[model samples]
Target chain A: MLDTYKKYFRFLVKYRGMFVLFVLMLTVLGVINAINPYFYKLFVEALPEKNYQTILNILILYVGVNLLETGIDVIVYLLGDAVILRAARDVRERVFKKIQDLDFAYHMTNSSGSLISVLKRGDLAYFGMFHELNGLYRILVHLILMLVMFGAINGQIAWLMGASFVISAIASKYLLAYNLTTRKAFNKQEDNVSAVIVDNLINYETVKYFGKEVKEQRRLSKAFVLWIKTLWGFANSFRLIDIVIGLISAAGLWVVLHRTFTLYMSDVIQFSDFILILGFVTSF
Target chain B: MLDTYKKYFRFLVKYRGMFVLFVLMLTVLGVINAINPYFYKLFVEALPEKNYQTILNILILYVGVNLLETGIDVIVYLLGDAVILRAARDVRERVFKKIQDLDFAYHMTNSSGSLISVLKRGDLAYFGMFHELNGLYRILVHLILMLVMFGAINGQIAWLMGASFVISAIASKYLLAYNLTTRKAFNKQEDNVSAVIVDNLINYETVKYFGKEVKEQRRLSKAFVLWIKTLWGFANSFRLIDIVIGLISAAGLWVVLHRTFTLYMSDVIQFSDFILILGFVTSF
Candidate 1:
């Protein structure tokens, strides 16, 4: 993995400034998000004081902060697009140039259909990797920050939240692994379906001469049957992941909120604290 | 659009039972979601009564309701996949067969690369259309249900939410139209990029005979340049939509919450009502 990243790093190094700025913006966004629940705590706590203008001021500031977050998000996306797309373009061009540099014998040995599929899938995979990595980074930052916030208020609740996170992360890991396996199978079938169609199209002359149009059509139909089956398998894996994650989140929310509500009832914490914790968990 | 859906309705009619069940589940889900904020109201309102048992019961029921929602979501996804994928398979097979039935002269006139692109994109477009339409349906259901709940509490707030929805919808219509235009341009450039590569691959022998590998490489390089430009244009359009929609949502949220909070301060509404409305808007 390190070796693979090292290779990708070369492409990104050219856009180092923009990439750095993008990461900075993402980190800023994550921090802003982690701190957001505190604002609700502030708002709710202010209400009991019955100072309308002060409350309104807090509300305005809160909205302003949210607006700022949106602005940062826009900037992050623009920077990400500028950096990732350019680097990907460079990588693609390099790959294209290298392919052309291959000897005649290599070209004769390989089917161009599969080659095109590999290249297309590779380009998309690059973008996917970058996008998912950024998502993971943001989630990590938010989770850690939230855990710290939770710990500051109540250690037991923090531990509960932490345990749930660990469990959910582990569950996601295994579930996503399973999902990836199904996805690979689906992708292979999809490629096969396209390859069949493309080959038929490319070999139109051969099919016409042999009068094998019906044969090719039957072949594509068979491919579609498998395609449909694998597609469902892939889709079903997503449902499985959602069900598992949803269950975990619900269980976590129930436990944490129950504890927080009990604390509030007993005067162990204020109502705003309860609301803050609720905001944090639900937003998660 | 009605005629287009009429054609799709034929495919869906085969799984009419599942389709009905899916729609019913969606409605139930939407109703459950709209009422969810009221649970927070109940929880908060019950606090002063010092009714631990009652509160716990409400909490349990709340979690149970959420679990039920998750269950329905899973069923909806499964049913949707079963129905849509199967129907789409039939449509794809019919299109494939129809393409084969086209005369030899038609086949001779059209390039296979573009035809293959059409078939592939069309299959995806069918899936996309179904997926997006279902999403729009869910949003519509959820919005209307939410508005009804809001109206029951305060007509002015309902009007506020309704107006925000209208404005957002109109903005989305225009913004998405812009997005679609950019997307089409991107798709055209993407197809051009791939067509160049596929054509070169398919005519490898011709290129090899002419020793035009360098020229082919340069052609692909030029195509990537345009592809990058159009892809950025497409990506930027999404940012534009997010900024506009985010601004509208924040403004609407600020106004509604400000009104609700002022009412709570003046004792025109209970603390629970404020919390409930806050839950509704934030959840949106």
Candidate 2:
């Protein structure tokens, strides 16, 4: 996976301009989204006073901002798509070239399916890394922005939310480690099922001529059942993790709400501020 | 494409029980999502009354529903993954078997790259068809549900939004058509680049022994330029289409907002209903 990602990174860097543009667009979009909660707060604050003109203006501005963001996002995606596809073509070509130049001993040992699988899975894993990097970056940026905003409004609540976030991160890491093991087991079972299906299909004519349809079907069915059993176990484990995570997030929300309400009752925070926090926590 | 889809359909039906379960899960998930707007409306309505207990209950219920939905979604994805991957494996095996069995004449006529492309792209196109079918079905289901919900709320607003949906659909279709053309051109240029790269890499030692590094680099650079020019053109065209579609969708939203406001002013709808419409309209 690391090697695959390194290769993909090198390829991406070869087209650095497009990637830079993509990152810039994402940054701009994130900034726009981060500011959006404030507009909503402003709109809600003006609503009770029957400020129709202010409401209309806010709505129009919100729509315009959303449109601008979407437009930029679309352009960025198009550019990204072109870059990725072109990169894949180049990589595939390189692999094919490498295979051709490889020694006869290498060809004798490596199955075509293995090579194809490597290329396919490697490309997917590389793409996964790219997406994960971007997602982690975005989350970190948003978290920092939220922290600064919350600290400015109410430090105690921000600190509480921040602590919960740290706990959530640690919990998520543990869950991921556990889940990865189950996922590997599930993947192996799936590979077995695929092996059976492939063997049957490659000799499909022979199976039909030999009147072994039932035999083949039974074999596939057995493999599939095993796959399902393994998957089902994984699913159950995943569900348990999900439930725990959900509860933790809910608990965090409850804490934040309690703090906000208590502060509001004590006249330390306004209702608008409370709504803004709610929006930020939920949206982010 | 049709033949590929038919073959995949047969494969899927051969595993009917799993397919049925997957579809049922998707439908249930869709229904849950369709009903969620109503829940949001209820939550908003309760907000003004400062019903803390109700809000807490709603929040818990929301988290529970989301967790349940996610669990179900994961299972469905696993099921689908098992089927599709197994099917792909079978197809790959069959293609390999064919390669083994094919006459020398056929092999001589086709380059290894072309054959590889056929095997890879054929299976991909098969998967693409399945994806397109699933998308079409989901869109249809969601559209029907939205129309029903919208009609129940306000027929005039529903009709206007429906019209906008039609416009969006037409625009999407046009964009897709244009994309297909550009994609073909881009693919052809990419293939050319690939051929050159493969040729150079496969003869790397020969080139090095003969000190042709500069010559090979120049050749590769020429291919790279061709690919870049084609890609740049493709991206520009795609960007133009995306911008147009984005603008149209924004305009559609404007129309929906106008209709919703008019209905609200006439007391034909409430603020909550308008919010729900906004959610549904802009979700795509």
Candidate 3:
């Protein structure tokens, strides 16, 4: 997997300066995503104080920031498209060329159907990796910015948020990994159903000659029974993940809200700030 | 498509009580999602006035709502999973059985790989449809609840919110359709690349006998060149969609924020309500 990723990254970097700009745009978007909520906090404070000048200034700035952020998002999306598209193309081209360079004996033993599946999945995997892998950088920037902003509000709140984030992240990763394996099972069962359909179709002439269509139907239904069981397993596993994640998020909210209550009661935070903190955490 | 959906829905209804409860859970979750933000507004008002009883009650209810939402979400997810998994299983089994019943001659011409791809994608499509289709019901409930709440606070702001939602929904639909086509093109290009690789591998001996390894590389490279151009087209079209979407969402924000500012200036709403409205719209 590392070797494959290295190969993929090499293609990403082949275009030189474009990839850097793409990364930069993602970072900018992440910062905007993180800090934009603060404007609401400002507006919340300004409105209650009846600070007309401050309110007007903040409204205008807020709209401007939103529009600017939208503009930056377009640029970031474009850069991502360019780098990822180009990289995927390069990788597919290289893979195709390498296939052409392979030994004849290796080709003879391999099934074209599976190879086609590999090729198709590989391109999609490239697309998925480019977004998810590169977005990691953006997520990190957003997270750090959020942590700092939370810390500035109150240390305890920051700790709660950070701990929640960490626990949920870890919990979801495991849950998702389990989901992935179950999904893979679904995929395999799917492939088996496909193989059955394809094999039956390919042998149509023999079946017709033997007049065994009814027998074939019975055979297919047997596959269905197994497929149903597999589907149930897959779906059940997904529900389990959802349940676990939901409970984790709920627990986090309970803890966060409890702490916010204590802090507000003790006058450690202002009403507006309390509102701001709750908004931030809930939105997060 | 309608007929297929009808069949799936029939399967979903086969287990009577679960489906109704699932829909109820989704509706409840939607209302919860919409109303949860208003708690911050309540908190803001309660804190400054030092209404300890109201503050405590609201916090308790707020935490209660969040936990209840999490619980309902789990139930809804589980029911959805069960219904969808059963429905999909029924469909796949029926399809498999039908394949077996087909005239033997009908199967002779179809290749296994293409059939396998169809079966796999069909199963995934079923999974995607179940989640997205059900989620749509939840979204509608959420949107209606939000609009009603906004209208109660301010009509013009409500109109602005409603219009943005409609326009963005339409824009996204059109944009998403175009993206689908471009994605299909990418898939086709991917298939072409796969064919080249698979063909070269299968005919490895012929090339080896002819000592045309370099010639095969050239052939593959030629395919890659076309594939690269197709990929760029696909990527460019996707970026176009993103830009259009960005612009639409930005315009929506601008209109909504402008209306919000006017409402606040006129003192048509409370300061905390202003904070609430801004937070809700922006967070949305």
Candidate 4:
């Protein structure tokens, strides 16, 4: 997998311009998003004070910022989509070409499904390494910037948020790894089920003529039941991860809220600052 | 497409128990979500009085509800996954059996690649239709429930939300349809590029022995250029759609904000109600 990712990255560098544009657009969008909470804070503060002019300005700014961010997001998505589609197409074409050049003995020894699986995997790996990893990198960059901004506002609060994020990240990584394992198992089980189903359906006439439909159905059902059990296991595991993450997020919010209240009561934070913290925490 | 959907629906219905359970779970989830805002409204109303106990109770209730929903979601996902895996396995087995029993004349008329494509399309269609349509239906159902909840809370505001949702839905549908067409075109162009790549690579040794490397490179470059051009077109089209949809969503949010401010200024809505309204608008 690591080697596949490395190779895919090299392939994508051949069309660096498109990817650079994608990254640039994402950076712009991230900056805009990071700035949005401040605008909301300003707008909320202006609203209660009956500062009509300030309210109007803030509203316009909010809309303008959102529109700008949306435009950047659109461009970023398109660039990423183009890069991935092209990469997948190119890689798949190369795989087909490779297969065609392989010796006859290689062809005879390998199942067509296995070859197709290889091509599909190659295509998927390319997409993940280029499109997904790039997106992940962009998000990480933006997250760090946001954390810096939060730290500037209140270092203690930022520390709390950062800790929560780190914990969640670690938990998510473990969950994802587990999910990957289960997903692979589920996929294999599904493949078996498909093999069985297809066998029965295509040989329906043969089975019926042989008066073996009942026997075939029983065999298929047995495989299907096992598939169901595997699927249930996968879903239950994912559910636990999701629930834990949600609880962690809620706990983080509670801590932030308590800190906000404490700071406000101690006259260390203004209402506007509290609102800003709330907006940032909620949105992030 | 309608026929395809019908066929897929029939296939799903063949596993009626699982299908019904899936729908029921979604409906229950939708109903619960529809009612959740009211609880928030009640909780927020009690907050200003320094009602920590009620707030804590609400928090606990919120967590409990969320966990319950997650539990149901997992079960539904598991059930659906089981059904689909079984269906896929059945189909693939049937296809394999068919391939084994197929006459020589049939193989002669159809290239292995073409047959593979057919089997692939069938398998994908089976799984895609099952999973994608289920998701689409769930969204539609959730939207309806949201509408009902919004209408119950405030009819005029609900109408405004409905209008924005309609516009967004229309824009989304149009953009998706356009993207699908462009995607299909891009696929065809990529297929042609793949064909050319395969032809050249398979005869690479022949071309090298005949000192035709430069000619082959030129030919490959021609195909590559066409592929790139097609990619650019797809990118441009997708970008246009993304921009349009993003703008629509922004506009929708703007309308919601305006309605929220109007209700708040008129003193007809509490903060909790406002929060609920925000949730509904965002959900749309």
Tens-digit lDDT track for model 1 on A1-284? 57867887788899999999999999999898777767767867787788888888888887788789889989999999999988988888788777767777998776665677667777877888898889999989999988898888888789989988889999999999899899899888878877776777777778778888889888988888889889999999999998999899889878887887787778888767777787787666
Ranking by TM-score: 1, 3, 4, 2
- The per-residue C-alpha lDDT of model 3 at residue A254 equals 78
**Candidate with more favorable, higher lDDT: 3 or 4:** 3
Off by over 4 Å in 4: A1-4, A33-40, A93-108, A138-142, A182-240, A243-284, B30-47, B91-107, B172-174, B187-237, B266-276, B282-284
The best candidate in terms of lDDT: 1
TM-score per candidate, chains pooled: 0.92, 0.76, 0.84, 0.78
Worst 10 residues of 3 chain A by lDDT: A110-119
- Model 3 TM-score? 0.84
User: Which pairs of residues have clashing backbones in candidate 2?
Assistant: none
TM-score of chain B of each: 0.91, 0.86, 0.81, 0.79
Output the worst ten-in-a-row residue range by lDDT, candidate 2 chain A: A110-119
DockQ, structure candidate 1: 0.59
For candidate 2, the per-residue lDDT at B59 reads: 60
Each prediction's DockQ against the real complex: 0.59, 0.17, 0.51, 0.25
Docking class of 1: medium
Candidate 4 — what's its lDDT? Answer: 0.65
Q: Lowest-lDDT window of 10 residues in candidate 2 chain B?
A: B111-120
Reference contacts preserved by each model: 0.66, 0.12, 0.67, 0.25
* Residue pairs with backbone atoms closer than 3 Å in model 1 (clashes): none
| Model 1 ranges with Cα > 4 A deviation | A1-10, A101-111, B1-10, B104-110, B208-210
For candidate 3, give the lDDT of residue A228.
71
